[model samples]
Target: MAQQLDLVDFIAGLPMPAATAPQLNPLDLLPRRPKAWERLVAHVPAEDVRISVSPTWTRVVVEQLREDGCGDQLLGNGKIRSHDVPPDLIWPEPCRLILMTADSAARIHERWCLEEAPGAGMSSTFRFAQQQHADRTPVSQQLRLLAEEQS
Candidate 1:
């Protein structure tokens, strides 16, 4: 058999991914009180792509990780993947969200979570970047305001 897959059926069967781990900086999901999002971070291939999208690159696999339906999705080569957060998530508080690059250029990445755990105590980290990956995006999108640093 050619290793077949039933993706459509998989996501439907997925039980709204739980916070399988603990939370670190669990920012209250209340939009009015705080604008922070409750992200259940995971891991994958490249955390960010670092593109200048005015001129698109069709074959670039990095951009797909940012899409909503990216999870469990397949590429032309028929491989399903995601990106990983980066490093620097170690050290103590400050910017607990540690972002490390998969490459020297600092384009893509892996992940390590740091969020708030509901009743689990104060906060904890699952170390997803070292374990697995979370999502993917370009350097421009991932680094956000730090593009100049990579240049």
Candidate 2:
């Protein structure tokens, strides 16, 4: 005869669900600021630097402060580089300069999708929340304020 399985034993072996589901905020999904950002910003001349933050990356542009007398100098030129913001970094402060455009938000959502397991896209509710956040926040103005504060 086949061995009999106890129903109570099987039920006990299953994992227990949490009493309350944790709340999810869409802003929590945004990319974090890069490490050592303050040091980087401090070293560069504030007026010559332009930093733009998107959901996937942070772009730092340090323009040349002086033009060469020989006319060889590149106008409107500087070093341009991008930093990928990992998921573990902290939010707020430097991250206050968020790109609020739909293109940027879509890129962020795409990145989140790729980072997660296949077929695990972000929830519609969270997407809506993100849109609301983008709408209410004047991020570009905040960026200017943050830059001023840093300087």
Best by lDDT: 2
Q: Residue 7: error of model 1 in Å? A: 34
CA-lDDT, candidates in order: 0.29, 0.33
Candidate 2's C-alpha runs over 4 A off are: 1-5, 9-21, 37-95, 107-151
Q: How would you encode candidate 1's per-residue C-alpha lDDT over 1-151 as one tens digit per residue?
A: 6976699987798788565765422222111111111132233222221112211223333222233322222243435455433333222221222222222113322223221111122222122232223443433243333433333
Question: Any runs in candidate 1 off by more than 4 Å, and if so which?
Answer: 1-131, 138-140
lDDT of 2 by residue, 7-125 (tens): 99989999998787454444345544344433333343322221232233223321111211111111123322444444443321121223333344445444332111111111111
RMSD of each: 21.1, 16.3
**Worst 10-residue lDDT window, candidate 2:** 116-125
Give TM per candidate: 0.17, 0.23
Return the TM-score for candidate 2, rounded to 2 decimals: 0.23
